[model samples]
Target: MTDLLMNPTVARLTSRSLLGRKRTLLLSLLPLALLSLCTLARILGSLDDDIAGQLQGSLSADLLSTFGFAIMMPLLGLIAGTGSIGPEIDEGSIVYLLAKPLNRYTIVVTKLLVAIGVVTAFGALPVLAAGVILTGELGEIAVAFAIGAFAAGVGYAAVFLLLAVITRNAVVVGLIYALIWESLVGGLVPGAQTLSIQQWATAIIEKTLGYEAQLLFVESAVDFSTGLLALVGVTLVATAYAGRRLQTIRLHDES
Candidate 1:
């Protein structure tokens, strides 16, 4: 089962390629920006204790939930996920890997795993750090949003990775989804929130913080049950479909 799910060689190669200097720099930019924002907010807040107190409450939560979860997480997921395999496919290097005696599903899973790790490290961890920087403590706001960031990271990675498998223009398509569907539409339209990964992850933060989430107005458009179900469902279904897509690509190449 483990062998079917992962290939060490594939994982190593995927990590090497994905974390090449250019990709690493791209991934680092967002997190650095996030932390810098948090630091600036904190510095400004320290000017007045009253301002600091107010900033620590709603402003901190907003930074963590709004910018961190809604914006940075999905964008990081898009970069890491698409970068994991899109370059190989685009450069026609995937054929070399596919020609080997390996399960296509295993290949997909291995790359997905690497993408998830990258998202977790670059996306989720930065949210956690930003939370601490903004809140100045490891409180409910920090912890809860950190967890939410992680959940969103997982969903985004899977969805974007699948997008890469299906389209050479995955980055452009993913930016539309991340910026349009998840950001603008999801934020403004109540009805569309049900279909949003950001809302689902916000639901998790709402659930984890419970009453505290309410105090900061950290609410999700969807309920916790719906959010959890959608998160798991999207990840599984997208990953399975990506494997199938890879198989089709292989058959076409053989022909």
Candidate 2:
């Protein structure tokens, strides 16, 4: 029996599917846009620390938080997390793996690891590069948002991966959460911000960036400690639940 901890073949397959053809092009959108936006923002404006800090903070909170963390990371997470296993289950090909001696936990965990890695590479890394580009230095603001991006990636990947296991409409659900709740409601309602993944991630940014974060428009709704707990809790609960769901998964014979 192959180790349930990780199967090299599964990892390779996930990597190929995630990075394949149209998906690679899809993943490039955020990085390319971020780079272009930051490059233009930097060039069009003068370079003073005060000005740099203001611009960086504005981009970090207004632009990056709205687009990168709220929209991009979750969408990337939805695509990767759901893409990793959803297609197999839809094709009814997952039954072959389930029929084998592998632990369901192993399958869930391995696929989750791949999805998280994909988000980090495509989502978190680009945000970091964009941060550096906007600020023109590897300063605290750049580093703080990089950390926030990774945290947001972790939260998004776990939740979407669970959605993939539980529902066929994972993408639909993910879009509602990413777009409607985050973009529309969170902006209109104050309390909704407290429960948001984007807000939780900004809590980390608030704590880490210290004084520089004040230049930004919004403060994180939750405290730093609460954000950490919420992030960890969401990740653990989603991953555990997905593994449990995988154990009892019923395959339909659509042939």
Per-residue CA lDDT of model 1 for 111-143, tens digit only, reads: 999999999889888888888888889888888
Which residue pairs in candidate 1 have backbone atoms (N, alpha carbon, C) closer than 3 angstroms, thus clashing?
none
Clash count of each predicted structure? 0, 0
- Give the alpha carbon lDDT tens digit for every residue of 183-251 in model 2: 677645788988888888889989997876777655888999998999999998998999999998776
Clashing pairs in 2: none
Off by over 4 Å in 1: 250-255
Native-vs-model 1 lDDT?
0.89
The per-model lDDT (C-alpha) reads: 0.89, 0.81
- How close is each model in CA RMSD to the real structure? 1.9, 2.6
Q: In model 1, what is the error at residue 204, expressed in angstroms? A: 0.5
- Determine the backbone clash count of candidate 2: 0
TM-score of 2: 0.91
Can you tell me which runs of candidate 2 are displaced by over 4 Å? Answer: 1-4, 46-53, 56-60, 253-255
